[model samples]
Target: MIGFVILAIIALGGGIGVIVARQPVHSALFLIMNILALAIFYILLSAEFLAAAQVIVYAGAIMVLFLFVVTLLTAGKDDREPKENLAGQRLTAGILAVLVGGGLAVVGVLYPSRAIGLGLPHNFGNLRGMGVTLWGPDFIYLAAVALMLLTAAVGVLVLNRPRRQVKPAPRLEERES
Candidate 1:
């Protein structure tokens, strides 16, 4: 319960950070915080395998890719400013945030300690069971993840590939000489 509270606070803070941050790199870092908080929640729920996978796959690989893209695409600090006007955007976002927050608060009040009643399934946190479940019933998802990672790898490679250079022609007198 205490763990859940901590994780929820961290997740909320990260959510706000991601929204309020201006720099792409800062936003990516905030996203990493959110992923880590979620991983902690999984751990608290007795899903050790899922927690590890979340940290490894999301916090490790995906966030690394995000940072790489931010670094490669932005080039420098000069590119951190907003590309478009933020006029009236804050009001809309604030309204949406309030709606979501109110909905969540209502749900929390209605279903307090709801997860406590969920009995742990057999082999809930067992490594072998998780392995079998992943490789057996969820192989398609695993394959999809592999393909997605492959696509992201290809994207990174393409993005970072050096541009072709074109040499300027010599002046007429130098060419003639």
Candidate 2:
């Protein structure tokens, strides 16, 4: 229970850091921290396969992909853009964040009685059990996620590809000369 609470705090803090980070790379690092905390939570829940998947898939692959996208977009430049002078944007953002936090606190206080408990089988944490569960009913959702990732990767590649430069035709005088 203590471990769960610690991991939950880490996850929550990392999530907030991800949103609060200014640089994209910093945001990705924060997201990785959140993923690691989630993996730890999975371990605490006796979901070993989920823990491994969370670390391997989300922390490893997805974060790497995000970093790559950020790097490509930034082209290794650290030039920070000038902040927008939108009046009250910061105040509005702060108010919205407080509202969201208060709403979540309210939900946390109120939703416990409505929560349902499900019993897990003995082999639920094993890879074979996870495979069966995933490949059985949730295969379509898995495939959709894969397809979405592939599409995003392709889109990034397309956006980052160098365009062909069409040379202008020489002027008549230059051609004659």
Candidate 3:
């Protein structure tokens, strides 16, 4: 109850931060915070495997990928233009977003779902089930995809790494002085 509320606030706050963040890296970090909060929510919902997957996949792999791309994009950017001209636009967008969100909230509260739940199946969110599925016939495809993505990320990093600027050797005339 209380935990859910706290997690909800955290998730919402993180999501809002992600949207309003000026820097791509900061946005990615805020997204990670939101992802982590959702992972906790999955645990609260008795979906342990989902929680783990949320943290491992989204918070870990995807966030790293996002950071890699952000780093690659911003690495050489030393200067940026002032954003004062967009202040009015930002405020207007914020107000419109709040109004739309509030309207949706009101509609949801006024008309809640009345459908009965079918509930989770046996071992629905258990790790063993997920492990078995991963190790099943399609394991090769999954493994190959994972390998390719990881290799690609590493390759990008290696290719884009900063190289040291080396000075050339002095000529005989300069060395004589």
lDDT of 2 by residue, 1-177 (tens): 688778888999899999788788888999999999999888887899889999999998989999999988977687676778688998899899999998997898678643337667758898998788779989999899999999999999999999889787677557743
Off by over 4 Å in 3: 76-88, 115-117, 128-177
Candidate 1 clash figure, as a count: 0
Model 2: lDDT equals: 0.87
Residue 130 in candidate 2, Cα distance off native in Å: 1.8
Task: Note the Cα lDDT for every prediction shown.
Answer: 0.86, 0.87, 0.87
TM-score of 2: 0.69
User: What's the lDDT for residue 110 in model 1?
Assistant: 86
Local accuracy of candidate 3 as per-residue lDDT tens digits, 1-177: 799889989999999999778787898999999999999999998889899999999999999999999999897686465668455887898899999999998997789666527676667679876677668866998899999999999999999999889786668457743
Tens digits of lDDT, candidate 1, 44-84 = 77899889999999999989988999899987657455565
lDDT head-to-head 1 vs 3, winner: 3
Q: Please give the distance, in angstroms, between residue 66's alpha carbon in candidate 3 and its true position after superposition.
A: 1.8
- Model 1 lDDT, full chain set: 0.86
What is the Cα-based lDDT of residue 65 in candidate 1?
89
What candidate 2 gets wrong by more than 4 Å, as runs, is 22-25, 62-78, 113-115, 164-177
Order of candidate numbers by TM-score, starting with the best: 2, 1, 3
